[model samples]
Target: MRLMPRSLFGRLLAVATLATLAALLLASVAIGHVLERFVMRGFDDRLDAQTMVLARAVDARGRFDTTRAIDLPGFDEAGSGWIWQVRSADGQVWRNGAEALPVPASRADAPPPPPPGMASERARDRDRSHPGEGRDRTGQRQHFRTLTLMRVGGPVAITASGPRRVVEAPLREAMLPLLGSLALLGIGLAAATLVQLRIGLRPLRTLQAALGNVIAGRQHHVPTDLPVELAPLAHELNTLIDQNAEGLAHARRHVANLAHGLKTPLAGLGLELADRDPDGRLAAMLADIDRRVSHHLRRARAAMPGAPGRGAIPLAPAIGDLVDVLRRVHADRPIAVDVAVDGVTVGVDAQDLDEMLGNLLDNAWRYAATAIGIAAVVDAGKAVITIDDDGPGLDANQRAEALVPGRRLDEAGPGHGFGLPITQELAELNGGGLVLGSSPTLGGLRATLTLPL
Candidate 1:
């Protein structure tokens, strides 16, 4: 049920064409009316002049003078289709051209109204066809232009008339070129409309192409040399792209610093554990070695860049896989991981999503007493994934402290307290963030991760 076109160009072209055609149609009607009036005015003027000629020939004695009245060349012909008539209270007389046509009976009595008013009345003419042609002797009907007047001494009706073809033929001839000119004008208007539309919309089209280039990774920023109307938009887009790039570069540098800072400790641990010592101090050192390595590895994973074409990870399967692994890991605890994720997909790299979800689920398994719940949905063009656990959740103060990079609230717990910070960093890298709150349903901590769609 779409009546109008969808594209801007199509809609604009259609509207412009319709408007132009409508204007042309209206103008044609007005011009045709004016032309008809002009042709008729000229015809009536000629008839009036001839009528005055016939009137002037009559003297003060009211005598019809054939010698003087017949001086006009058309009057001398027998069937030229031009004819005249005169009428008064004393008498009425008329003359025909070479056609030898009779005067219309109504003309003498009433003069058939004034000139042009009687123009539609058909006059008779001889048929040019042979007897075998099956044509009428009176020939085709033709209209005339008749004029009537009254003299001082007597009522004089003088009509100089001709066939309709004589009047219309000239009008038709003139119209051929007029119509041709109007057609050219219409075509010119159409071309101008298209050119105006293209020039007016060129900046918007260029902006669209530039955006496509950025999305396709062909360009890092939109071009800035645009019209004043579009310049701000391009500048803002470039600024956004530069900001994202800077943030990504900063994250990469932080990860590199983490790796470099931990290198010496890792090397020393490797040497101590290489002796294969069986003492309690050696076991504690081994535990510390595992914690440090796992924390730094999670940080590095979280810092990885989210590039284009690095496929989005479906929230349901990713959370489900992590939940299944954690369930097995904590079999003795009897933790119930309930997943309620539908068709939500997060715009994050698959490996990054896995590392973030793995750390979060593992943290929940260590803390949760029995039941854990996971759910996801799409809202406002973003993916919202929430995980809830039924356990002794941390307070506001503890929650804030736990998000710090290396803050451990529960040192006795089987984690290095890097899960929330790593997950937060990973979410941000994917144009999203993480939130910690109280779960109303599970009466425990609720971890909400919001990522771009």
Candidate 2:
């Protein structure tokens, strides 16, 4: 128990365990005090009994007729601090010349001492014997008690006093076993606390394993045998995976339908135009159909942005990779790219962002004249990526039309009228947009894509 517990269960159980230890320690100390008083009082009772036994020995003669010195009971001043004194009827003392006892106070309504055979009395010690009669009280005394008895002559008082060090000696020897057992219990409690923490955290580890399986594309749903507190999170993850599968299947079906619908019509019209005005009109329509087909195909390639598997892709590294790949493709032209983006990371589907930037960089390489420059900067509230090339720029009207399907800046290629439109659609997919602007560095067409932070 320091400021912080080492583990979760340790912190929880330490509160109860430490509290119980403190309460038990307090009770033990209190009981130890009471027991010390009781043991000292038991010793005083013996002294009272001895004084009465000597008083009964006297007859009507009132004579000191003890047989031997060793016959006196409790008269040995040996262990247990035992002592005794015997007095006669006229305040005269006998047997073991002893010090005067420190007399005690009594209640006004207290009963007087009875006859010698059944006599008993108790009292607390008073200050002194009439001001100055050789008093002695030191030695850091533990417990003190006084006893009085009545006889045929005068009252005889018996008193007992000792330092607590004598009683504490035996008590400490007895408490050793109990304290050792409690120490062992404290150690056992610590071990139990660690075991409890491991058992309690098992559910979290199982949930993580289920997520790992889903990420590796092994299963669509997680098992339901989870703890009650963690069941909601498991249910939500399973439902999300199911929804993503259904949506992707539907999108694939849509792409197939579009491809089939356009392919059949273009083939039929091409055969009929073989005998009429066959001046590439059927070919142009076929090309437009192909462009439209490719546009929908790229849509299927874009990521499902709602899925949770997308990790943070560093914008700078992604841009650099795309630029390097395009550089090898356009090695014939000395196209130079200047990158100035920093450590800004954006939340994007990894494959989707790669495809978007790849297409944009390829487009710039194809149309650039002397130099193609790539610049990325945070502008206003978005990631503004400007790909500029020093080539013949598009006019205002063509710039607007080039972003749509079946439109291109230069009208000559295998898969024509589809690159810019596909790039535009991808830009808007992940909460971003594509813009047609004049390049500040190259004085040509600049494809500016703004992704919100």
Candidate 3:
């Protein structure tokens, strides 16, 4: 379908190379034409000189002196394909040597005098294959260039002729090296253009890589160390990133304030209901309302959309803090919390990361028999943190239901089953995910969290 390339590099290279080739082609043609013209002019000069010599050597008595030392070697040699002819008023034509060429018929007894210099006088014959020159060395019919000069005193004309191929032979020989040089020049120009394109576009490539780092949460903003032409673009992108971060932060704060402000009102309403309704007829309704309010409040506190361009926070310290707090809370249970996390970073807000791990670790401590194992590492450009506990782990169905909000497996349990669901939500908000499976090493339920590296 499309003949041209789509990339900027391809299109630019193609256009530059084509332009270079066209320029070289035009220069070659112009130079070649000029060379051929110059050669033809030189041929005409020789014919003019010979005609002048012949006209001066002859006398007004219409007699050529053979004893005179005329240095016209071409005319002196028979069958040389270079000849001279003289015409007089009596319709008589005298040729110096005519072993190979015919004497052309005269149109009139006496011809008009030629111009002062040797002039281009067209002969009656138009064919290029002269009888004097049947064919040249290449077997092509040899053409001739003739010049005529007339003496002013008497009705006399002198014409000198030379082969046309002499003028063109030198031009043909000169073209080979000329065209080779131009071809080499075109190649050199193409290479230079490629280097120029790479150097010119390097700034754009750097900008693209910097943007990718920002998007992946590895850097805070585009680097300002760019060319003058691209510096404005980097500044604009940094401004936009700052604007988006401000907007998200404002929205989160508003939600948190709203949730906290509603808590007192909900509590007062519950007190008023308890004082008014003594029969507990609305007990279930009040419980549901309280649960919904608490859930909304919890979500408001935990809703962190992970900061843009934040480097991954270290995982070992966060996991250790959560494990230490949980161990103290369940000290009487004799639970051993083993933490193996080291040098791993998670791309999430520090508070949100703590909340997610705290929920998982606390839930594990509740059901663990004796031990809990926590480890984290980087895998496939993601931070994978796994927590395993030797507890009465949930089966497949229960694991699936545990992520549902407020879905508790045991109605008589010590705590509400909102931990896993809250952790899942926090993970999702921070561009991470949570998965639950049986722990192969700990012989209990395993929780795996995957987040951006």
TM-score per model over all chains:
0.48, 0.47, 0.57
lDDT of 3 at 116: 44
TM-score for candidate 3, please give it: 0.57
lDDT of 3 at 14: 86
Per-residue alpha-carbon lDDT of model 2 for 1-453, expressed as tens digits? 578689755576778577757866776677667766676556545544554555455554444446532334434554333434444457665544343333323342222343544433222221111111111233233333433444345445333433345556777775677567666776676677667767888888788788877764456688778888888888988889889878867877677677767777767877777777558776776677776666555445443345344367778889888877877877787787777777666655666677678878887888888788777777765678888888787878878988879776676744577777877776776667788878877988898887655
Q: Report model 2's TM-score to 2 decimal places.
A: 0.47
Task: List ranges where model 1 is wrong by over 4 Å.
Answer: 30-34, 61-63, 71-79, 97-150, 217-220, 232-350, 353-453
**lDDT rank order:** 3, 1, 2
Clashing pairs in 3: none
The lDDT values for all models are 0.71, 0.63, 0.72
Give the per-residue lDDT digits (tens) of candidate 3, residues 1-453: 997999888998889988998999999999999998788777766655666676665675655544542547566776566666656545567666553323333323223344444334423221111222234343444433333323334345555666656766798899988999998998899889999999998888999999988876679799989999889999999999999879877877887787678778778877888877888877667777676666555555554555235456888888777777776788788888788888887767666787788888888888888888988888878889899999888899999999999888978767687888989987876777999999998899999988876
| Candidate 1 clash figure, as a count | 7
Candidate 3, residue 410: Cα displacement in angstroms equals 32
Error of 1 at 193 (Å): 3.1
RMSD of each: 13.5, 13.1, 10.8
Best-fitting candidate, scored by lDDT: 3
